[model samples]
Target: MNLGELEKAALQYFWSHEEADAKQVHAYFETKRGGSLNTIQSTLDRLFKKGLLKREKQGYAYVYRQAMSKDAFIGELVADVTKDFFKPTENALHAAFTSMSSSLSDDELSELETLIEQQRNNARSE
Candidate 1:
């Protein structure tokens, strides 16, 4: 499922904070996005089914945690966006990477370089 704004926001919130129950998430939405408790609960369920979250039993309620980090989530989104929106061409990929790289911080850029190096090493080994 494509993560619309609300779902994406919920994931972002979960990534920054520790695990939370549906009621707690609903309260967060009430303060910010103003959704009902049931709505938040439904959203959480949807996220769980989408493999974005893992839920654990917490007494009468279930506490949910992120299944992936924010960076991993963004990477998946970027890959999906690339496949769905861009043409299958080297130039398109190059342009997409260039556009995205300009917004990265120095630390993020360093991390990306490390990832690319690892990818290259993997390719050589293969």
Candidate 2:
């Protein structure tokens, strides 16, 4: 499922905060970019339609929670990007790693190396 920028932002907000009401989401976005409550509500409704969000009636307000975990959602998004833009090629994966590796800390790089070694070992075993 393709998510618009506003829907992605709303989902991220709910993911980070656990749960949020429309008013709170509206205020959050308004601070970042001036938008009416209707806009936020519409985007949230769209997210609901996309099955990315679940809403519960809390008193007079609706509280929203993410339907998918952050990691799962990110994995799905990455898979979609790889499929559509990268065609699942080794060059695409290498480019992504190269771009991201520059930002990795020493510990992160060590962990990545370990992960690569483990994967290599697994491939050999298979």
Candidate 3:
């Protein structure tokens, strides 16, 4: 998700729905985010060119779909971000996490703990 705002919005639109023409995407922003049609179309086209989206011609318009599943995309992002974030030290990450953890719900903290335990177990097994 290290993309520009319009690119992120366009990707989110693709994530929640099936392939759509640029016009459909533009219409959504026109109502929801209130951006111009050209902006939406340019974002979609840029995403297609960047290999983040699949595009196919349907009669006159090109319909676009996400190239990868949202889960996969997020997993890659998390891995990349963690690699960068934890490059300094575990203590730094811990301090940052502690500061941010207050904003998370109890269920979210529990789930994160479970995931951390799972990763630790997997690492030990490996």
Predictions in order: lDDT? 0.87, 0.85, 0.84
Candidate 1 Cα outliers beyond 4 Å, as residue runs: 85-95, 102-126
Q: TM-score per candidate, in order?
A: 0.72, 0.65, 0.65
Q: Rank the candidates by lDDT, best first.
A: 1, 2, 3
- Tens-digit lDDT track of model 2 for 2-48: 77888878888988888888899999989898899989988888888
The number of residue pairs in model 2 that clash at the backbone is: 0
lDDT of 2 at 35: 91
* Model 1 lDDT at residue 43: 88
Error of 3 at 34 (Å): 2.1
RMSD of each: 3.6, 4.8, 4.3
Candidate 1 global TM-score: 0.72
- The residue-level lDDT of candidate 3 at 18 comes to 87
Q: Which candidate comes out best when scored by lDDT? A: 1
Error (Å) of candidate 3 at residue 36 is 2.1
**RMSD to the native, candidate 2?**
4.8
Cα lDDT of model 1 by residue, 10-119, tens digit: 89889988899999888878988687888888889999999999999979998999999988888777777777776776455666789989999999999999999999
